[model samples]
Target chain A: MALFTEAFLTALLAGAISAGIPLLLVGLGEQMSEKSGVLNIGIEGMMLAGAYTGFLIAWKTESMGLGFLAGAGGGMFVALFMAVLCVRLGLNQIVIGISLTLGAEGATAILHYFQFSRTYPRLPATLKWDIPFLHDIPVVGPALFGREPIVYFALFLVSVFAYLYRRTHFGLALQAAGDKPAALDSSGVDVLKVRAVAVLTTGALAGLGGAFMAIVGAGIFVPFMTHGNGFIGIVLAMLARGRPLWVLGGATLFGACLSLTTALQVAGIDIPTDVIQMLPFAAVMVVLIVLGSKANLPVSLGTAYARGER
Target chain B: MTSEMAIAPDSGENERKSRLNMRDDRLHFLIITIGPVLATLVIASFILMAMGVSPLDYYGYIFQRGMLSPSGVQATLTRMGPLLLIAASLIVCFRAGIWNLGGDAQFILGAVFVAAAGPELVAILPVWLMLLLCLSIGAAAGAVWSLVPAFLRAYQGINEIITTMMMTFLGGSLANVLVKLVFLDPETTVPQTRTLAVSDRLPRLFDTTVSSGVLLGLAAVLIVHFTMNRTAFGLRLRIVGANAKAAVHAGLPVATLTVIVFSLSAGLAGLAGAVAVLGQTGNVRADWNPAYTLTIVPLVFLARFNGFATIAFVFLFSVLSIGSESAARRLGVPNYFTLVTMATLLILMAVAEMIDQRRRKRKEV
Candidate 1:
């Protein structure tokens, strides 16, 4: 009759990881874009596009890998506009980003209406890859080590991003573009090119994250299923302050809180569901505000770079 | 001696060229402003074609239903109340160079505050007085909700966009909680606040179905426009917005202006919410978001911060929104098609602005 039974604890842990993976992917991607001086407000749109395409592809081909690829492609497709308009053409990033998200939402919803409205097909449970020794460990073992390959891949991306930021020339270039575009331009590096590449990569990673949400996290795609995850990712990236590890930590905390909400609901807690559901958002914002206040964003963030113009 | 003689003729030629440039500037401005709208319509037509709907027919139906019909016009007029207020809110923040994306949150909170307080106040006071109290409470709530982001941006240099949006998500959840648990009407099976009697609601305008809230919306827009353009306070806010560091050096109250802008913007959004409830809906429902904030954003931007222009655009937008529902159902298309069109218009506008900037830079070179 205990509320904290072993089975319940394990489910909560598993749910946390499932929720955390998409956020991690999005945070990492957003961090890269921010590093290169692009805020990427349209990432939500990219995520939605990825979710739709990823789900559609997975549903049709019955292959998760192909679905993830298609999702990334769809995200990049939306990002192409971001690169051209915000980065190349020097448009206002916020306005363009908002429009892109709205456009993507409408486009995907219409696509869904035509293709899947009647059937509303859902994907099967994703295949998990169990790590040999890790899978046998108590409560945490099955939850962390027995997730789908995408979960591990998402975890691995944290390390990959950390390495790229700390030890790579490309990372240095990205940092320079965000901090001092004029200096970077003077040094013969193409600021526009750097920003364009960063934005596109952000799109790809965000798309992959969206795909993971559709295929592994939810086992289905719904219109606007990304549901502000992209915005949460922005907050994570900002709070992380260029630290990939912090992004991982923040994402994990957020995901765990989400799982806790679900647990509370399932346990028949006598509270309004809306209040219970608000825990994750409130928790994340409070934590970030308290802990990440000193974190510094890029100086040149959200400003268009015009050569020789102050 | 020869160089001096040459300079005199070149100076005269430059004078003529400058006058020509002045004449061309007006034409360039017109192209930059209007070209994007035409482009968006053309692109949206392609999307309509892809959806197997006739663009002309859809647009025709929208015009017929939204503007030509009496009921549709009334509906459109009623819808404009929230949009115009939100547009006024946006004008304040954007003119101050502050991005207060929390209008949606402020709006929902405002509505919730009115829903919870209006019925109780109605019992104690006359209907008009009760309505005034509800509106003030809603505006106060919205302003309170916005204070955190405003303070953060003004003092800590935090970006308001992320903070405001986060607040929006939280506000939405809180609104639902208020509707379902805190202020649920026992009489109704549905999770909604206690509805006000029809007699207690805002009086209809000219005996038409349209609510008098439209007049309030127009008044708010006019006041905002005047505050942003004609007054010395407006000039000071503009100076602060133009360059905060410069304003500080000039001893202008940059921080105070920032907070004031946010309060005014959020207060207007709250007023919009109050108007929607008292003038039309009469109550709040769980998980219901009019989403008036996002819908009005493009209209505000398209108007270029001009109050009269905003009224025209809001009129057009409300017509599209109200008229498109029937057309969407008939064509088997989603009502979101209008969103697609509006979003496209916004993008095209950004692109046009970019192009205009590029051309101007090229001319300077």
Candidate 2:
């Protein structure tokens, strides 16, 4: 009858990891785009599209791999419009981003209604790989070291992104594209091309994250199931301010907060469910405000680049 | 003497070419305005086909039910009340180059406040006075909700888009909490605020089913349009929006204007919430959001800040929304198809605008 049992605590830790992986993937993707000076507000749409497509593919083929690939493809499909309208055509980024999200939501919802409304199929349990020595440890070992392959891949991406941002010419070009596109252009780099690649890569990563949410986290996809994870990812990326490690930390913190809320509700805490739910959102915002107050964004973050129109 | 003769003939030819370009420009303007709408419809038709529904049948139902039928026309007109008001709110903020994506939050807060306070106030005051107070309270709450992002953008240089959206999420959660926990009508099994009686509600317009809120929305639009176009205060706000540095050099109070613009824009959204409750919904319920804010964004954009054009676009949207509900049921498609169409329209409009800009630049060259 004890509320703070070891089992309960272990479950909470596992839940946090489950919840955090999507945010981490989305944050990393968003960071890449922001680094190239594109604020992709349409990521929510991409995530939703990815979720539906990923879920559909996984359900149809019983292959998680193909599902994830389709999810990324779906996300990239929406991102293509973002690239064309906002990046190539020199339109308003925010407006186009919003339109894409709305469009994606509608498209995915309609697709779900037609294909799966009558019978909402849930996926089988996901396949997880256990690390040799780490899995033998106590509660911490199982919760951290034993996860689906995507979770490990998502975590590994932090280091990969860190390396890309720190020690490469492509990384330098991305930095210059965000900070001073004209200078980058004059230096013989194609600013638009760099931004296009970053935005597309962001779509693929975000789509994968959404697929993870549907295929592994929830084991089922529902309309608007990505919820506000995409927006939360934007916040994480913005607060992290070019630091992939910071994104990892923020995502973990946010995920932990989400678990805490669920734990509170399950324990029959004498508080309104709505207020309890608000905890994660409020906690993330407060932490970001305090820690990221000094974080500086790219100089020309949301502006469209024009070659000679200074 | 030979150079002068050559120049005179060339000048005559250039004049004819310039006149031809002028005529082409007018035709281009017409195409640019209508092209996006047509593109959106065509794209939406493909989506319909994929769903195994005939696009013609769906469009027919929407037009017939939304505009042609008497009852459908009434419903569409009634629906326009909130849509028009929210469009007005968006116009105000977008004109000032501020993106108040928190309109949804402000709107929900306004509705919550009005629903919580209206029933009690009716006991102590006359009906008209009580309604007025409820609206003012709603507007005040919405304005206060927006102040956080406005203050942050004005002083701390934080991006309003992210902050406002976060606030919207917070607002939605808070509204549900208020309904389910704080203001729950004890007699009802459902989680909702105390509903006002019919007598306490806003009277129907001209003995018709349409709410008088539509009239209020129209009045707000006209006043806002005139203020934005005719007044010096409006000019100052526009200058601040057009170029903040130039406004600063002109000695304008940029920060103060930012605050005021946010307040007025949020106040309009708040009023929309109040009107929706008093005129139609009657109370606030848990987990309810009409999502009027985002739906109206594209319409306001297409209208290009013209009040009359906004009214026209709002009418078009209302017809689609009201008409599509039955069509969705009949065609076995989700009602969300309208959102897809609106989003497509917005994207196409942006593309069209870009093309127009390119053409203008070429002409300048």
Top model by DockQ, which number? 1
Query: DockQ numbers for every candidate?
Result: 0.47, 0.44
- Cα lDDT tens digits, model 2, A70-168, are 999888888898888878887777778889999999988877887777567899998889999999888788888888888888999999999999999
Q: Tell me which residue pairs clash in candidate 2.
A: none
TM-score of chain B of 1: 0.87
**Candidate 1, overall lDDT?**
0.85
- Tens-digit lDDT string for candidate 1 (B1-365): 00110101124676577678886866875787679878877898899899888989888888899999999899999988988999999988877777788899899999998988988989999998998888899889889999988887777777676788778888999999888888999999989999888788878899789998899899999999998888999877776666677778999878888999999999999999998998899999888898788767756765677899899888878898899888877767689788788788888877787677677769878
- Write candidate 1's Cα lDDT for A229-296 as tens digits: 99999988987889999999988887887787666555655566678668877875676466546448
Cα-based lDDT for every prediction: 0.85, 0.84
**Candidate 2: tens digits of C-alpha lDDT, residues B1-365:** 00110101124676577688887856875687689888888898998898888989888889999999988888888888777888889878777778788899899889999999999999999999999999899889899999877887777667676678778888899999889889999999989999998779887888677888888889888888888877998777777777677778999988898899999999999999998888888899899888788767766765677798889888888898899898877866688898798788888887898888787779779
Residue B188's lDDT within candidate 1 is: 92
Residue ranges of candidate 1 with Cα displaced over 4 Å: A265-270, A288-295, B1-30, B360-365
C-alpha lDDT (0 to 100) for residue A295 of candidate 2: 46
